[model samples]
Target: MQKKVPQIVFDSKKPENSGIEILTIESLASRKTEIIDHNPEKAHQVAFHMIVFYTQGESKQLVDFVWHPVKKNTIIHLSKGQINAFQFTKKLKGYILLFTETYLKNQINNSPKNEYLRLFNTHLFSPSIQVPQDSNIIRYFDLFYEEYNNHTEDLNQQNTYKSIYSIIFSKLEGLKQFQPFHLKQSKQVNIFLDFKALLELHFKASRNADFYAEKLNITYKHLNTVCKATVSITAKQFIDQFIVLEAKRLLINSDIKSTELAYSLGFEESTNFVKYFKKHTGFTPNNFKKNYL
Candidate 1:
């Protein structure tokens, strides 16, 4: 028999890297223990823009449904509401900068929209770039650390914060190099983006193809074709996947009994939820938690 993979839940409270709080930043730095067996039980939802800048470490970033490696100097940009995870390496060295999206928005509205956020979002899975230790990049970060250290000071507080956001954006744009995935979007891609947004919000309650088709104002056949063209999964499958993920989350993360879990998940009865879970996963809820939890 093949050895089963271990699915571990990373406790966020312990051994956290500090730079900025989830949606707020003022120059943060820390080293983390390896996160190999750990999986964050919930998606990190925040209004801030997060930049995980690693120096001498590696991490696997789970973005959407794909995992991407992040090595030194190359930053991973996670926009607000994007579901992502940080699986840290054993030897981790880096500063994680978490600033409100508003900070970047203010600068972009005044200046050119920063190219770094744009490029990074497009090429999220590409290989990392190593920044030279003695380079100006390191020197620039030193200044960031200094400013962050002085954040509590009253003098020039507003100006200092403004400058920080501007400097970071400028540095990211200066790294101009990007991968092929950074191409401008096509019409179909835009439509798919909208579809994904809808699915994220309504997947639990809307399980039928016609439900989404009516909302998108398209025929069911057209909706299925669009979903298949982009994601290769039918709309119903996408809905089921979302529901299943939620089921797994509730099962593993909560202390609630299975009967309650079923009802809360919108099942008409506890038995129905148990049956649905068994059909999809080949095991009952208790078995899943026993083996995987």
Candidate 2:
């Protein structure tokens, strides 16, 4: 018997109200038992964006099967569709803001849509940022928290909240510019970004670099050159990394049988999938499952 991964949908029953919610880490920790009483060990696939700021205390969370440490003044963003589970201490203190895609599109109208896509879309790096407990960054979050809890439903209030939200991300983007691995703007970088988008859409059906190159209207050699220049990895390596990542996500988050998992990942034969997994990870499927699960 195979168990399915739990998919959590945002509460969309009230469209008139803003599609956003905010809570403090302390508040969430108090209700931890009530929240996880149903399935304590299951990782939830959230259907909304989660922005977490850790102002104090230390904890850890599993995002897409990778456990990230949460320290003071740290910010973590979890885009929609990522599997996550929390392990926080009782002293945790911070804010957790959950917003739906609708809220982003409707409320944050001042920023371009591509900016949102670039920030929220976690492909090349972990969607977490570390910052000194500077007053400027803290001020933006404080304003957002106050606005979120004000309980005002008027248009003017909504716009005010949206403005504060935009400022938070704007500052974060500025910090990202100084990151050592930040992708620079160039023709090669653009091609790599396009390749990643296409891979996300077609990885389940096609893992060939040539297919992606055709979709990008670029030659396979050019795609490989761009990938090597941008990330120091070849184009085919990028495809395999995406496939293996999804494989691990499924293996840890669900109870699907090995054969079914393999087939779902576009493998025609289960043995081939096992071999592929072993070649990349140096562990058989069963061994990997035993180690992680």
Candidate 3:
């Protein structure tokens, strides 16, 4: 059995300081149908981007939107902060390739293709993409996996791997050029995504909508409009969501007491946190912990 992944941590240690862990299709190929029911309560931040090319599968991928009918030859982009879950039977089989965003940064710096750069760099504002199944694109994607696996043992492994990954992203970028659907303007999407980024950084400091708007240099009205346009929620709703999520994560994942957890999240008193959480989530923080954990 594959060992359970250790408690996910966001480590800032340099890459060379900690040897990278690489997973290959040939290694995970036979086990595609296995179910991985666990999810990170809070998505783990990764230095790399994840490209999951599904050749055969029947599963739902939760990205910016939910993707279902996961069949032969589908590709998905998973950027940071997109929480996901998986339920698979014996039919799932695919290649999941991960390499640092630094790889793409290097590509843009060297070759400087506008369309390619735009697609990979969308995470600054939008953090996920779901690509349609395309036969031609699938062929190139398979080549990427084959090329990486076949040349993995080279003396200059990192260099060879880099070349192979570059080729894969270059080919993948072509899909953007000839997409069947008109991809929505990503800038519109980023307004909300960047707001979420702000939430991650400041949820503990303040849960007020005006606080985010001030930092973003936009009026609270504009912030609320942007969030409502994208996610059908108000800015305050999003802020509350983040606070509640963080509250739950700390409550379940740590041994800290409820009152301390409340104080850590910026509540002056534990009772106030309890009242606030109950007002928003309809459950006291303690009850949420008892039921959910």
Q: Largest TM-score belongs to which candidate? A: 2
Q: How displaced is residue 156 in candidate 2, in Å? A: 2.6
Q: In candidate 2, how many Å is residue 244 off?
A: 1.5
lDDT of each: 0.57, 0.77, 0.59
Residue-wise lDDT of candidate 3 within 1-293, one digit each (tens)? 21222133333233441222234333454554462533432222233556666667566554432344455655666554433334454677777666555555665676646545445543322333345555355555566556545633455665655665666666666555444433444665667767887887878788899998998899999999987776667899877766876676566555678799988998888998988889887998667656644
lDDT of 1 at 159: 65
Off by over 4 Å in 3: 1-49, 61-69, 74-76, 80-85, 100-130, 151-160, 163-194, 278-293
Residue-wise C-alpha lDDT for candidate 2, range 1-293, written one tens digit per residue: 22455667676333454777777877766766786433323566788998888988898877887788988877888888788777768687898878988887775476865567557757755677777555378787788778766765666876676778888777876666655677646787677888998888888789899999999998999999998888789999988988988897788667778899899998999999999999999988778777764
lDDT of candidate 1 at residue 58, scale 0 to 100: 65
* Span of 10 residues, lowest total lDDT, candidate 2: 35-44
Give the TM-score of each candidate: 0.60, 0.86, 0.65
Task: Give stretches of model 2 more than 4 Å off.
Answer: 1-5, 12-16, 36-42, 107-109, 152-155
Task: Tell me which residue pairs clash in candidate 2.
Answer: none
Task: Give the per-residue Cα lDDT of candidate 1 at 192.
Answer: 57
lDDT winner: 2
Q: Is candidate 2 or candidate 3 better by TM-score?
A: 2
In model 3, what lDDT does residue 277 have? Answer: 85
